[model samples]
Target: MEDAKPMLLVLSLLVVAILPTLRANIADFDEVWKKRAEDAKKASLEAYDPHPERVTQNVNEEVHEALEGDDGKRRNLKKYNGPCTATNPIDRCWRCDQDWASNRKKLADCALGFGRKATGGKDGEIYVVTDPSDDSLLDPKPGTLRYAVLQPQPLWIIFAHNMMIKLSQELMVTSNKTIDGRGANVHIANGGQITLQFVRNVIIHGLHVHDNKAGNGGMIRDSFDHFGLRTRSDGDGISLFGATDVWIDHISMWNCQDGLIDAIMASTAITISNCHFTHHNEVLLFGGSDTYSDDKVMQVTLAFNHFGKGLVQRMPRIRWGFVHVVNNDYTHWLMYAIGGSQQPTVISQGNRFVAPPSLFAKEVTKRGYTPESVWKSWNWRSEGDLLLNGAFFVESGSPITNLDTKDMIPAKPGSFVARLTRFAGALACVKGKPC
Candidate 1:
């Protein structure tokens, strides 16, 4: 019995000594299994890789090819050569002081001819003051001219004051005239209640409409008084109130009370492109009144534009419409990209969203905000929303089957440059200039 006891003790001691070594081996085996699992996951992802650069190139090529005809030609030419500069001959002479430099006899004859032309002959041609300066030809009283020329018709109406001379509540633009700003500054100051009501096929291009202290008491009031002054407009920058086929391009608006641009009441086929809209409450608004369900589909396209900063909630509060918001850079702001009610079909694609921290990080600690809060505020559901390198947010249950990060084109630091490069050739062709 004594001999058996010593043998048992020695065996127990050996087992105890080896138990630690066995545990170490098991741990080692577990670590190897974990590494294999991770490696398999990585390999699986790599198998379905979508090359980003290749996709970007494909998109760029397709855009360029599509814009190669019609508008593309004008765009290319304008890029290489600036806009054409042409004006009336009399205006050019007056500008050069060539008319003033001539001798007294020629000047007198010129002045007489000008007067005779201003006053109609005995044939009852009915002389009307077409030019603002031609008010001298009248009896020199307010509202005394036989006929006041509307806008953009008289070649002498180059500046804003000239256009404002006949700007009235009852003033109706009955003629087809092109009011070219000539890339110059046209200011409307204290012009009382100007409205572009019942005008068609009007193109107000390359003009800066600002600081018109026009009291909102006449026939037309500022759009801001009716609608809140969140956007950069005293009234609205350009109100297409019951107008159609209006094209507003290449204009910059800031520091006004209402929306930068407002299209209301059955305005159809409105195209707002290549314009910078900032420092406002709402950049672009559609469907002020819901009268006709058929016209609700006004078909507004907001493309190749920059919308951000100096304002909170800068999205188009669209109701009842098909709005295609594509290729825009939306960064540095608050609230929804688009928020409104009704059966509005919003096609929001190809946009870069740089959230607070990142989509992947567990927590985002910046400006005392969190990932959860940011996601909620932006109406982003993380579970459904896909994250590409910690950016971009699509709606939950979206029809987007796949958002392969590998297929995403890498952008530069700022969203503006990224968007430009993404849709560079198309924008260049559309704007008639290099992007």
Candidate 2:
């Protein structure tokens, strides 16, 4: 342990004294927090109010128009202009495809961060998961989801029909694979888990994954070439281990045995977008722990998601990584929304957080058992975010001065969060319906 007395003094002077004023610039904290609560209520109403324009134009044109203006706060959007116009930058990359199934590879091109180029079977053949049974954990048949993911080659896996698949054990996913459940209703529920280990270039999209349980590990086939034994799984909906270039999008997850999504062992370049999470304790965990300091390479983008109902903490709890949490709706949480340790850099923008009724849990963050002094030095920042319902973000670390952070489009505002995260969950896209 360090000599923390001096650090404690700084924490008291900066965080305890000056921090409150910097957060809201008000003398009475309750008054300002009350005002924020009212504002959040108003914003929530406006968010849920029916917007006719949504039916007319699929995307929010005002947001796009705002970015187009020469007000000089447009960020770097001009680089992907013309055809690539969306309210959310990540959506602009892939959602334009009405023919998304035919051009499924386009999703890989739309990713940002360390996982930008995760093609996941973009160059391979289509494999349909006609069977939902995981009866044969080893040497699964071609029609099952397990078998489709195990093939070593790049493959696009799609469900043949609406089905809820229960796995006897965790499904070990191989590299260069895309499991796309867009056109059909698919659920990986009833004690099923998916693991990505020592692989690259994978994409998982538009699936409801929940009700997972700990796996009593046995013979599991990881790839077409090899079969291996494993330890017990923690029942994470998706676990990334020593993997890179992974993109998971448009997922709905809840009530997992562990973190809904856990990325450990130096997984980098990943994006988790347009997802919904609920009824979980620990939601997302990035990096392994404090001892795994080499996880400094982790760069992740969490965008356009909805954290709704019955959540506790770790909307992502991070350690030794740079996490970008942008343009999402956080409707409720029992404990805290975001937390971390090991001096991670967290950038939160263009989001809305409506706190739960508990007074003690009003704050939106938690420092993982570190003394105030050490945690205060971490670069945790909030810009253009809407903190409502008396929800306040306790920020520390250095002010954002760089151009990349300076020119942020400020989409994380509370008003914009509703529209930005309007489409958070699995879609019931019929053949010709807008997804």
Candidate 3:
């Protein structure tokens, strides 16, 4: 007891000496994060689609049901039974209930990103795609996926039976439409791919899209009124060009000829969630060109997706965009994952990354096509990420080491990522059963 006083004094002095530097570092981090947050909000509002037929809300103002309660408390399903209520915030918004089929439209409210306002045909007619054929690009048949997409009216599209749809040309999805493949085995494969250009308010869900081939774009009908000449498509599973307010969920894709999903040319307000990606290279890209600076307003959210098996790089290689990549699981990669260039701001939070065995490729980050002298200034933060199997993230930009503040508590502990991403893909559900 006599020696305790000296030891206490020494510890107090040490803390006094270190506190100033720690506080400075934390303040700097907070300022940087604050600016990024403000800029992201501005971008979301600036890119808000002004389509007269629909109301698109500001993406940042929306609160997800799973993340916050009515009075703003984080919620979990400890009170509920069966299949373990999803801990991932998006899944908890509507996954545990047995009435998901009946309340299918509830999925729209769970969207988190620039595209959060995409209610998708909820206010319109329900159209069923009964045929698997796309015989003519200029004149699509009445009962096919192509026909359902081309209609100008707001529509909730569903499949009549289990089938695979192979298109002769890229299926140009029109605005304010939802291609819902739930409750059936629906697929688009060995086909000409899906194109969303100059459109708005589109939702694609619960489909297996793979083995997509390039199409020779010619005089093809894009909407109910126009058919324009075009060039050959680059054969992506899904391509978004100059589109807005789009949400893609519960998709299973593999072996596409090019990128699985490509959002380019000022596409904004987009969410890509609950999809399973495998057997692909160059998985997702946010911007097509660095010079297309109009894409600076692009704000995207990638959450609750599984980047699995045989993927190479570009788990969303972004350019000039504000992207939130949260709670996704990355299990396999031949090359590095999560790269960016051209001043993209990426926030990677609550994700798990298990790298491959190659010592040279164990790093989880790469700055694409840019010299360190330039890329070093870009903001790419990894918070609460599990870098397993010898995986390490090469961090750059402003150091955010000390965040001892209440509001800016860094993402949940990295150890918790496993539980957060466990249910990363589509739930294999059955009728008269819980999902």
Candidate 1 residue-wise lDDT, 1-435, digit = tens: 988999999999887555422221122324533443354334323322133223233332333343333231121212333432111111122222323222111211111100111111111112223333322211233222213223223211123222333222212221122233332344332322123333334444334443333222222111212111111123555555444434443454554445666665445444454355556666566766343353353545554445555544435666555554544555534444454433444545445444433334312111112233332333212221212344444443233223333343221223222323222111111122221
TM-score of each: 0.46, 0.79, 0.80
Clashing residue pairs, backbone N/CA/C < 3 A, model 1: 75-432, 190-213, 229-257, 230-281, 232-256, 233-256, 233-257
In angstroms, the error of model 1 at 336 is 3.0
Regions more than 4 Å wrong, model 1: 1-62, 66-178, 187-194, 211-214, 219-234, 290-295, 354-435
lDDT of each: 0.36, 0.74, 0.74
Sort by lDDT, top down from the best = 2, 3, 1
| Native-referenced Cα lDDT, model 1 | 0.36
Which digits, one per residue and each the tens of the lDDT, describe model 3 over residues 1-435?
888999999999887555422221122234433443355445445665443112111221221333333332333413335564566656677777688777777777777655677878887788988999888788888999888898989899988888888888788888789988877888799978898866778899888999999876676776776566555677899988767789998899889898999988677889898788999989999988777777777878887678888999999899988787766788899888898878987777667899899988899998877998888788777877888999988766765443222234344544554455555544566655656
Q: Lowest summed lDDT over 10 consecutive residues: which window, candidate 3?
A: 52-61
| TM-score of candidate 1 against the unseen true structure | 0.46
Query: Model 2 over residues 1-435: C-alpha lDDT tens digits?
Result: 368988888878776444321322223335534544354334323322132112112122324553454342333412332442345656666565667667766776766544556788889998999988888877898799988988878998988899999888888787789999988999999775888765677899989999999887777666676665555677889988656778898899999998899987567768798899999999999986678775776777787789998899999999988787777789989989999999988878767899888999899989978999898888888877788889999888976544233333444355666656656788766554334
| Runs off by more than 4 Å, candidate 3 | 1-45, 48-84, 399-406
**C-alpha lDDT of residue 167 in model 2:** 86
- In candidate 2, position 435 carries an lDDT of 48
